[model samples]
Target: MVKINKMLKSLHISNYALIDTVDITFDNGFNIITGETGAGKSIMLGALSLILGERADIKAVRDSGKKSIIEATFEIDDYPTLKEYCLANDIEWDDTMCILRREVAPAGRSRAFINDSPVTLDLLSHVAMQLVDIHSQHQNQLLTSPEFQLRVIDSMAGNDTLLSDYRKRYAAFRSAVKRLHEAKRKIEQNRSDEDFTRFQLEQLDAMNLVADEQEQLEHEREILSNMTDIKSTINGALDALLNGNSNALSLLSEAGDYCEALGRILENADSLAERLQSARIEIQDIADTLSAFDSDLNADPAELDAIEERLNDIYALQHKHHVSTVGQLIELRESFRARLDELENSSFTIEELEKEARRAKSLAKELAAQLSKRRAEEAARFEADLRERAMPLGMKNLQIKVELTPTELSSTGADSIRFLFAFNKNQPLMPVGGTASGGEISRLMLSIKAIIADKMQLPSIIFDEVDTGVSGDVANRMGAMMQSIAANIQVMAITHLPQVAAKGNAHFKVYKQDDEHSTHTRIRRLSTDERIDELAVMLSGSTVDNAARANAKSLLNIK
Candidate 1:
């Protein structure tokens, strides 16, 4: 695995430059930050986290009336995922990408920007998760979350497909069970409502309604019943306009010709000529319309009687069904058919469902058993690995128990695993955070993290006061352990212990200085000489005593 060497090369902070605004660059391998109690040591870690999407304190921003901006330039190793992201998001990448986070503390609002583009907190958190794992002092407590435990077991199981299939089966079974209950309730309801249902079905069926045919037949009946009177009216109108002695076309034609002759004598007679011509055409059109109507108007008494009977049948059905339109009748027909189908086969469906549910119950129990066995094996190995890493962190006789037990019908197979432990062999096993002290919990969390680090594919691990409870030989062992861990990965620690602080390949110091009207935090990447001086100060407080400097100088680990 590639570790951060010259990565996170530079940092720039404005309006948030601590007591003394300063720009700093980092070195490779291990970096340690140590200072006096009130010297703002944790501020650097907090700023880094804030830029990584952690919410910052409202008052943390400077009173200069400008937004706080934290910009970090990084030289990342060949990370294909990050490279793909940069390309996709239009971020320029050349072995380096700039992540800039800005917080507008004026409105108590903060914004995170990666390469100067505003991003949502979730996206910032996702990108930050790929870049860093900031282990806060309180992060140790998150290890005991039940959801976290279940996630671990499922990850290790590597049988997610099988578990997915099991969950699908479980869901189907639950649905079947619910449906079966509803059907039974419906049957009981039908028994109580048997008389009403029989009455509705019988009444609907007796209507024997035809769907669109009823509306079509009624229109045919209306036309047929009026045929005789319609034919007589059309004939009389056609004769009056065409064949009568005073027919309109005969009178209009003579008048039109007379006006045409008068047009030669008078200017206004031109209008009369056009009007006469239009009037003759209107008379012809009226005669043609009546002729067509007369041809189409024939009366047949037998057909009229048949049409009337059809309409009566439709009206009778409508009255019986209590519906006003043929469309409503169509809907009633469909409803009747659907309910009839349901009543017909509800028995067969219930029988098949009962059989399938029993089969599902048997299969679920079988798979759950196999899943529980695998989890037990994984749990044992997991505990062994945790205890092995915990030994050097002042946790001798520390016992880690991965308790795998069956939960009641969970989608994730059947196993529920929890991290349980005891400080000594004879002591009862208690949860990592509940019964164990803070120091013990911290060590346990570190041990667990160490055990999973390689598998987790994490390149850098930041420890915030991880050495708070350690002392003497145990503290010395921690320093050596961290150095060994650093040989393969980058380890940065915020420590008070000289052993841990002295073990880093690089060191920095954070301090606060007062100005004319305000306080600011200043951080400097310490050189060998500066580190030694700072370590001396950390060891002896205000008096740097020669022995502390000598101790700082002599401590070194191989690259």
Candidate 2:
């Protein structure tokens, strides 16, 4: 037997639904709770659900003035996954014990706590799920679910690493497909705008716009536009300075000669002669500059027209590109150049992306095929084991077949697996849901779960009235199976069957107590004698005769 370390240590529930307060401590093996109809065994499970992060209601508060509190403690040293959850949630707990608590107020508000530290309900649920599996009748319905079916097959095949690797690659493949689509979209969008971009670029390129070219053209235009005025002013200045006999340069020369003659006699006269000579040289230089300007200022209409045409083209190009200066147009042109370059390379980029997507898909297909192959093998074994388990439960004629048919590749694999069943040997196998009765399904589910339990490590298993429609030897066998399962892990059954109830290592009874104004439900762990009486009451109803007592004792192996 596997050594059991993680178990539900205790549950403390107060002012919840029917019970005002009930505190129960659990042992490590098979613990059973039995009660008459409408007794509070289900209520106890309900309270347990609250601490496991089930939604709560104010109506559950037995006393209007007090809050309903449900707290559960577990020994979880063996569960590393749960310990990781505690670390992730920053909950304070040790290997020996951990506490989960839920409180619901009269106002319908609720709060959850783990190890005295408050936590989100989601986090609390995450920790709770790792420690317990409450297998109610609803979970039996999950046997029909494909996701659940696949999970069982995967667990059986010990395909955690394979399935995990396949899923990761599938995710990558999906991502690669998404990226390819995005890249194609970008290319399509760019192509839509490419023609306009090329037209704009061509217009600018044809103009050959240059930085500072526009300013230079404007200056030239101004000169050409005023060429006649410039020539007249320059010619007049040259005449005044040098061309006339009484011009400024001639006057300065005459003055310089007089000063030179005077300078032969006086030192001041020589200084005056030097000043006149400097003035004459400056004026002559000015006249020569004006003469050259006059010669160059010919108003050539053809050249001016050419310059005007070029300026117009530059201005038009600037307007078309929505720019003010030649520099901005040059920048715009380079941007268009880059866009065209990208357009040219987009085909190559798309090809690469498509190739990558294809590789990812191919790898995913191979992994899926491997997963399907392994699952098929496990399914065959599972079918055999399930039928074997069922045969002992009075279902000797049960035929369970696991069919793994090929389908499109998905996250799980390329298989549409189903469990086919036929109760009679001559009847053709059909889907389990269609062929099996409720009781048959319940037994089938228990058999499957037992098989799964052997294959996997579940912290605890609870059967909430799973033996609803069966009795006699079959019920006893079910109890024996539950007992056998408890050898490895904690098992609890909320049952009404005395046969099942008698097999529990520890037994508890839920009953109701009445007051003047109200009735409240409560539970108590039964002593050996008390267990006999309870089982007797379950076996013989409200009237427990001597025969019922003897039968109860025989079921319990008491003298």
Candidate 3:
């Protein structure tokens, strides 16, 4: 596959550390950055780190009253995964370029943005991981990490899909096991509470609770308690309306007769008579209704006692269940019955879950075995490749082996991987960290990176003086390896070695400038002549002579 070139186009930093403001555009290939001790090369890397979602510190601010800003722009024309990542995360997407920015306020507050949309630090870190890989001197300690060792091998093995599949199977197995255990626990607990649950269900079933039954029973009880008053009132109303001598019905009838006589001589009198008739009819209906009510009002003491007892039962259940209505009590009763039913059938559920767990475990184990097989196959190739790459970098008698030991299935797989090394002939192999020197480790890291560069899918890698303990020919060889790797990806190196610095397609010099009150750090791209002078200075240390310039020209092949 033709790898898409995704490189950091430019980085802008302001009010950060010793840099008031610095903007540097990078090249697409090997880019070199060189500076004297304490000239702020690392500070520039620190600013870039902020863009990569490193933790922000208020102390990095050049001025306590001003906010520090770090922004990085990348060329990402054909990187579809990154575009998909932005869309997945709801970040604004730009087809050809991506901008990542970080701001740290004077109060130590931090914010990150992608394509100008706000994002969390974690998301920014994930996106930036695809854009750049920054290897510093401290990262050398990763050589001792088993996880890192496994990742290195996996990257070379091209096991992205297989690893993803194995992890999914492993996760399913873990979930199934958890569910099976929970089901067993639930069965045990329900067995302990079986009698109590059965008793509760039986009590609710005997009551046979109904919806709205409580309100209906309470209303019946109220009417029964006031039965005498209600009956007397109804009788009085019926008499006043119908049976009394001066009842409303009789007076309304007499008024209707007068209105009918007046209608013969007056126009509206007939309408008035009709209205009086309507009023009499209405009074008669009211008397009939009152009579029925009086007849129905029987003082049934037995029914009253029955209603009271039912209401007390309802209230007792409501209190016991912590409910306020008959509906809620009914719902609680059904829930208890459901729990009992589930308990009765719990053994079946447990059996099913156990079967599911066993299936999942079997599938995971199968995939783990396949993963182990592939890793074993790749381990031999990786061992040979590492030995070949490192042997050229001063490990003349290098003997490297990748140890893959069987382990219980984990998220990564069922293998524990370690890199064993013997830097001399007839030397017993030990773990790389115990056997290799700092310089040897550096070279091994570089060689590993070179082997996996095409697979990492990263746009750029910045080496922060990873060539720490090497000198002369080894440094030159490391630079050559970086240059070779850059043929397929962007490479940036910070070095004090002219041998390494001479190998870059573009060079930048970082230096300190002293003003009146404070010192400032500045970096600028170097011209061809300026690069030569800088190389001469790096070679001679504070003195540039004819021979150093000639040697610098010789290194640059400027004969």
Alpha-carbon RMSD to native, per candidate: 7.7, 9.2, 4.0
Q: Write the per-residue lDDT of candidate 1 for residues 385-418, one digit (tens) a residue.
A: 7788887677788877788777777777677778
What lDDT tens digits, residue by residue, belong to model 2 across residues 1-559? 4567788989899998778888999888899988878988878888888766788877788888978889899986677777776887789878889888999989888999999999999988888877777887666677788787888899999999998899988998999999999988877887899999999888878887778998998999999999988888887888789887678988898889999999999966778999988888888888888888888788999989999999888888777767899999899999888888878999898899999999999999999999999998999898898888888787888888888899876888788888889898798999877887777777887887777776677768788998987889989989988888888789999999999998889998889999998788888899998998999998888998889999999999998
Model 1 regions more than 4 Å off: 1-13, 16-30, 48-56, 69-104, 109-133, 153-204, 214-233, 240-332, 358-366, 424-426, 457-461, 480-491, 502-506, 514-517, 532-554
Cα-lDDT of candidate 1:
0.71
Model 1 — TM-score against the truth?
Answer: 0.70
Clash tally for model 3: 0
Candidate 1 RMSD computed on C-alpha atoms after optimal superposition onto the true structure? 7.7
Q: What's the lDDT for residue 368 in model 3? A: 86
Q: Model 3: per-residue lDDT, tens digit, 398-420?
A: 99888999998889989998889
Q: Going through the candidates in order, what is the number of backbone clashes in each?
A: 4, 0, 0
How far out, in Å, is residue 193 in model 3? Answer: 1.5
The C-alpha stretches of model 2 lying farther than 4 A from their native spots are 52-55, 78-98, 116-127, 197-339, 424-428, 457-459, 515-518, 540-554, 557-559
Q: Rank the candidates by lDDT, best first.
A: 3, 2, 1
lDDT to native, each model? 0.71, 0.86, 0.89
At residue 377, candidate 3 shows an lDDT of: 88
TM-scores of the candidates are 0.70, 0.72, 0.84
User: What is the TM-score of candidate 3?
Assistant: 0.84
